[model samples]
Every structure is written in C-alpha cells, then in structure tokens.
Target: MNETRERIALLSKALDLMTDRPIRVMEVCGTHTVSIFRQGLRSLFPPSLELVSGPGCPVCVTDQGEIDAAVSLAGIKGVTVATYGDMLRVPGSGSSLVNERALGRDVRVITSADQALEIARNEKTRLVVFVAVGFETTAPSTASVILDAHREGRGNFTVLNLHKAVPPVLEALASDKNIALDALLLPGHVSVILGLSPYRFLPEDHGIACAVAGFGAEDIMLALVEVVRQIREGRPRVASLYSQAVREEGNCLARDLIDRVFEPCDSSWRGLGNLPLSGYGLREEYSSIDALKRLEISINDTSPPSGCSCGEVLKGKMLPRECALFGRLCNPSHPVGPCMVSSEGSCAAHFRFSRGGDHPWKH
Candidate 1:
C-alpha cells in the first residue's frame, strides 16, 4: 500500500489498541482547532476517539479588558498600533480595533516585532505600539523585537504586553481533576520555539503524556493514535511526532532573547483564573517603552456578557453550543466574546462547521 494508506492503517491499529475503550485527547493549538473542524476530521475518526480543543488560540483567550485597552489606546493621537492579523477583528467593549480603524486611526499589521521597531524608528511622530499576543511560539519573536529595540535605542516603540507562557497554563489544566484528559496533543508552533526539553517535565512531573503534534488533519490523527497507544501500552512520556519542526533543546537564540527582554509575571487567563508567573512583563530597563508603565488606564473587570461561557469553552469544559449566544447572537460578524472573534477559537470552529447540524458522535 501507499504511504497515505500505511499511515491510515497505523492509525486504525493504534485506535484498536486503546485501553479501557478509547480516550479523549486535546489539541492545544488554535490552528489545529480550526484545521480539525475545517477538514471534517471527526466524521473520519472512530466514535470512541475524541479530540477536544484547548487555549491554543491567543486572541481568543485574551481577556475582554485587554481588547478594551487596545481600543482605548487606538484613540490616542500619534499612537500607531501594530499587531498580528488576528487581533484586528476582535471586538472590545462594542468596538474592535477594525472599527476604530474605520474612523481613520493608525493600525498596522506586522509579521515580526522587528517590523514594528522599524516603523517606530522611522516615524518619529508616531508612537509605535505592538499589540503583543500569543503563547511561547509567538512570544520569542516579540522578545526578539523588544531586545532589538532596546539595543538600538528605539524609544518610541513599546509593546502592550499580553504574551503568555505555555507550561504554566498546561499545569493549571493538568491540576484540575475535572479535565480527565487521557493525554495531551501539545502545540506544534510553541514546540518549534521552546522545544521538547522543558516539556519532558510534563510527563515526568505531571504524569501526562504530551505528544507534540502537527496541525494538519493527518498529523493530528496520528498524534491521537500515538496518545491512545501510549496509554494502552502502559507507557506515558513526552514525544515529538512532528520532528520536522520540534527539537530537544529548542531554539536557543529565541529563548535567550525572551529571557533578556522580559520576566515572568502573574497572568490571568480567560477561563483559568490568575496563574502565577504565566505571563511576561517588560524588564526594568525596558519599562520606559512599556505602555502599561507609560499610560495608566482604569480597567474594570466584568463578566463576559453574563451567560456567555467563553471562559468555560477555553478551558474545554463546555462546547460552543452550551452558550446561549453560540449561534443565535454570537458569531464571527457580531462576536459576544473573543472566542467567536478569533478564527482559531473553538467557538468559531464549531459555529463555522458544527452549526446548522450536530456532531456524529455523542460527547
């Protein structure tokens, strides 16, 4: 048989080997979340195997106060906002960055944090503010830009520090007994930066097998197979199925840059409450450029639209439909929370495919 057929056969065999009649595994990456839904992968897999999404999408999990802060910053004269393509659409207190952009405000889309520094250096009149988002995968890049800005003396450039660490969030999830995940399909993007060295601690320390897997349909299927296989064979360990990107030591330069630019700070997740040392803050020397340090804004913490269960969804506790606004009121166009706004969010994926229909299996 061909390689494709061989892979499928392996997956089928792996599923058959699962102990205690199948298991539940979570894809902790947002890209994986969207890809799984878009490819209609669930219908292809056995009903016994389940794939639940986690807080892999940074934009989706970013607290509502952050969205509001970004919109509030948008109105400041001579302040230029730079962010990934994802944050442009997320609504903040009835207004998204895009809505603010419609009123002729300055909002720039940047691939790397260095690009924002370049703009800040050249445009002396504009205060270049990078809307820093993402987990370990994207955080290193932001760290690189911050170090470069400080080294080059680019004072006009500052980041709205919303960067988060991966492992702590994982710990928070694992500590919660309610999750009951048999194994975890770790994020590929974050693994590319941080590598599998630190993740060895997950299995050794947390007693959970973390398979660093790719985001494609076939990649995820293979990961699920391996995860199930490990449990059945009575072997729990951290392994990399997507060796093309992930390594043991990870990217050293990226890690060094992240270390130099920022320090660990207490971070609050949308679903999981405040996690100690889960977020990043600008270092003391770089504090001059940090917007949070520069401008003081009164942030009022409010519940997400009363019954909106976006937080619970981020934690994988509830499905998208569990929320009253899932399809009726909350959607890509008119999002009640960040989950609906972000393309990688679980709610967006379910709304896009699972809506006007039902899942083939009973969860």
Candidate 2:
C-alpha cells in the first residue's frame, strides 16, 4: 500500500510538472474506465489532464436497432436467445431480453459462446441463437464456437453477429472534429489481438498520441505519463505501456480464426452512426448457421430514448452528470439507457464512485 502511494505520487508529480495546456485524453476501453474509478485514480490527476470515457463498452456501444433485433429474435417461436449476461437488461425499442424472458420467451444469459452451442446440442427441439457481441478479443472465441457448432452439425445453432472492430471506430472518433482529443488511452484487451499496426493511422493521419494500457491503476497512470510526454514534446505517436500482454504483431492464430469465420461489414454504433467495415458478419460459407439469414430478422433503425445522453457520453461530448436522466431516471436498477445498464458504462461507474462521497484517493 505504501509502495502504491509512492508510485501514485511520482506519476502525479510527473503529470503536474509536464502538463501546461489542457489535455483531453479519452480512455477508449470500458474496462479502463471501471478500473480508473475503482482505484480512485480520478482524484490523483492534475487539473490540466482531463480523462473522458469513450465508446469502449461493447454493450454500451451496441446500437439500439441491434438490441431491438435481438428482442425481436427472442420473440420467435421455438427460438432461444443466448448472450452474455451484460446484454440481458439493455433496453431496446420497447423491451429488453430480460423482459422478453419474463414474458416466457427463451432468453438465456451465457458466459461463453460454447454454452450456446451446448444449448443447441441438448435442446434439439428449440433453435438456439447466440447473440454474438464484442470486439476482436471476444470475436475469435465466437468464431471458434461457430466452427464447433458447424463441425458438430448443430443445425439448430445460429448467431446474431453484432461483433464490432475497434480500429474503424477509433478512425471514426479521430476524424470527428466535434470531440477534440489530444490523446487516447487505447484498449488493452483489444490491442492484445490487433497489435500496434491498426493504431498507426491515429498518429500518422490525425496527429493524436495513443497508448495501450492494462486495467491496473499503475498501468493506466504509466500510459497517461506517456501521453503527457507526447503532448509536452509534441511528438504524437502510438505507444504500448502494457507490453507484458500486448505485442507489436498481436495473436496471429486468433486473427486467422476470425478471418476464416467472419468478414467485415458496415456496422452501426450508438453514438457513432454506421461506420464502414466496422462490424463482423459470418462469412457466406457460414450462412447455414447465420441467425439473421435463418430467422429473416432485419436490423431496422430505432430512435434512442427521449432524454438519455448515452450517445453524447460515449463520444466524450458530455459527462454522465451532464445528462438529466443520469441519476434520476437511469440508475442501474432502472436503466433508461444501455450506458447505465452496462457494468463497464461510464454513467454506472460515476454513479457508484463519484456520487456525494468524499473523493476516494485524497489520502
């Protein structure tokens, strides 16, 4: 604990001494946002260094239209919808998967893609549809399971592929002039898969400094220190602070699995609209197990909730407190938006740690 304080003090001093102009850095991973709040790192930052949460939470960034489609899929006869637990309570156009389950629709929360396949193998009478959602880290696992189902000839198994790529969205964020970003704290897990190559464009094209960081407090701080240095010296580039896990090339076998099973398609994000080649669709060869193809459910656009500012929050345009519905109408229990419902959501983290209490890291 004493060591932690010394490290924090050193990094804090480094930031205070180096930072002159106001620097806006976005932590572009939901896990990073949660870790920052949980470790009380918010109180330790210098006033010139501002950290904002990006659309890093996979569940939070899922467009409302996709949620609605999942709900629609759940309502089908002889269909069982399986997805990660985080996706259960997210509100769609009219209802969520949990609500559909309450109404006797077969909506099951699963921890792994294999569980969905298991359900398909066991429940021969019912068609099990896995709601595949996540970035590259989880995509390879989903692809692996899709192959398992196909190899085992589990014809009742299909996937509502909502998997998204991080780089395309990062490119979109970098190009958006409305949200000024001096630097970005890139996602650790996603970087472990994508490596450093995909992020070169951010610095090369947009002139933004970025660093990949793990979920630990010190890991995040060290990454910030790198960001501060880049800003101070005006040499913006991509740096990986969490070199223990992330590699320059990333995992090749996983990438090969993703390529074999899925292909890039236009995907819609909640805050950011349809980004070209931002999402993964099961390849044409895998159409036999594609949920949308089998179920014939189209992902039509839907308007977000009237007062929820989740989109703005995701884009770093607004903080959680800036939204009127944040605490009033959108607490975790009664989430009016996906940002509040998701565990990695910026609003949820703020509500849990930043509400009415004394600052956690003051000591």
Candidate 3:
C-alpha cells in the first residue's frame, strides 16, 4: 500500500511537470473505469489531467437495435436466450430481456458460452441462442465454445455475435476531430489478446500516446506517469505497462482461434454509428451455428430514451451527471438507458462513486 501511494505521488508530480494545459486521457475499458472510481484515482490527479470514460463497456455500447433483436428472439417459442447478467436490464425499443423473461420468455443468465451449449445439448427440442457481447478479451472464449459445439454436433446451439474489436473503434475515435483526446489508457485484458501491435495506430497514425494498463492502483498510476512523461518529452508511442500479462506479440493461440471462428465485419455501436470492420461475425464455416443467419431475425434501429444522454456519455463528449435523467430517473433500480443499467457503465460508476460532487474534477 505504501509503495502504491509513493507511485501515486510520483504520478502526481509527473502530471504537474508534464504541461499546464488540460490533458484529456480516455480509458477505454469498463474494468479500468470501475478501478479508477474504486481506488479514488480521480482525486489524486491534478485538475489539468482529466480521466474520461469511453465506450468501453460492451453491454453499455451495444446498439439498441441489437438489444431489441435479442429481446424479440427471447419472445419466440422454442428459443432460449442466454447472455451475461449485465445484459438483462438493458432497455430495447419496447422491452428488455428482463422484461421478456418476466413475461414467461426463457432467458438464461449464463457465466460462459459453454453453459449455453450444454443447454442446447441437453434440451434438444429448444433452440439456445447465446448473446455473445464483448471485445477481443472475451471473444476468444466464445470462439472456443463455438468450435466445441461444432465438433460435438450441437445443432440447436447458435450465437448472436455482438463481439466488437477495440482497435477499429479506437481508430474511429482518434480520427474524429470532435473529441480532443491527448492519450488513451488501453485495456489490459484486450491487449493480452491483441498485444502491442494493434495499438500502434494510435501513436503512429494519430499522434496519440497510449499505455496498456492493469487494474491495480499502482499499475494505473505507473501508466498515467508514462503517458504524462511521453507527452512531456514529445514522444508519443504505444507502451505496455501491464508487462506481466501482455506481450508485444500477444497470445498467438487465442488470435488463431478467433480468426478460425470469426471474421471482421461492419458493426454498429450505440453512440458511434456503423464502423467498418469493427465487429466479429461468424465465418462461413461457422454459419451452421450462427443465430443471426439461421433465425433470420430482422433488427430495427431504435433511438435512445427521450432525455437520456447516454450516447454522448459513451462518446466522452458529456459526463454522466451532465445528463438530465442521470440520478432523478435513471438510477440502477429503474434504468432508462444502457449506461445506467450496466455495472461497468460510466453513469453507474459515477452514480455509485462520484455523485456527491456533481463534477468529478471539481471535487
């Protein structure tokens, strides 16, 4: 703990020495968002350095159309929808998975994709659709499960593939002139799958500094220090501070598995529109188990709630509290938007940890 404090102090000093101008560093991982709030890292930073949350939470960033499709699929007879618990309460056009489940739809909250496969294997009469939603960190596990189901001949098993790639979204954000971002605190978990090579575009193409950081206070502090140092020294590059788990080349086996099962395709994010080659879809070989293809479900684009600013929040253009419905009508109990529904969501994190201060930097 003492060493961690020392590192934090050093990071504070580095922030002071870095520049007088305000620097906005976005952390594009939900775990990193929660870690920053849980460890009170925001209070430790100088006012010049602001930490903004991006569209990091997969459940939070999932398009309303996709959620509506999943909800619609759940209402179909002989179909059992399986997904992580976080996706249950996300409001779609008219209903959520939770709402459908209460209406007697078979919605199963699963821990792994394999559990959904098992359900399909045992319940041969029912169709099990695993709502796969995540970045590259979790995609490999889903890929592995798909391979297992294909080998075992689980005909009833399929996945609503909402798996997104991080690098392309980051590139989209970097290229956008509206968001004034100085550096990015890359996701350590995703970096473990993609390694350092994928993030090179941030610095090489966009002139942004990046650091792949772990979830610890010390790790985040060290990453911030490195980012500040790079900016101060005029050297923008992608550096990995989570060296214990991440490598330059990343996990080749995991990459190969993902490539074998899934292919890059255009994907729609909640706030960010359809990004080219930003999502993973089941390849031709895996079409037998692809739910979107087999079920022929029609997805309609749905708008967010009337007063919710979750889209702006996801894009880092607006803070959670800045939304009119943040705490008044958008608390955890009755969430009006995905940002409030997700545990790793910026609104949820701010509501739980930073609500007292109205503005985080002011505190």
Ranking by TM-score: 2, 3, 1
When summed lDDT is taken over every stretch of 10 residues in candidate 3, the lowest stretch is 354-363
Judge candidate 3 at residue 294 and give its lDDT: 84
| CA deviation > 4 Å runs, candidate 3 | 357-363
How well is each residue in 195-247 modelled by candidate 1, as lDDT tens digits?
Answer: 88877766776677679888766787788777777777778798798898888
| Model 1 superposed RMSD (Cα) | 3.0
Name the top TM-score candidate: 2
Per-residue lDDT tens digits of candidate 3, residues 136-203? 98999999999999999889999998999999999999998889889999998999999998889898
TM-score of 3: 0.96
Better of 1 and 2 by lDDT: 2
Rank by lDDT, highest first.
Answer: 2, 3, 1
Taken over the whole model, the C-alpha lDDT of each candidate is 0.81, 0.92, 0.90
Best of the two (1, 3) by lDDT: 3
Which prediction has more favorable lDDT, 2 or 3? 2
Q: Candidate 1, 131: how far from true, in Å?
A: 0.9
Candidate with the greatest lDDT versus the true structure: 2
Minimum summed lDDT over a 10-residue window in model 2 is located at 354-363
| Regions more than 4 Å wrong, model 2 | none
Number of the candidate with higher TM-score, 1 or 2: 2
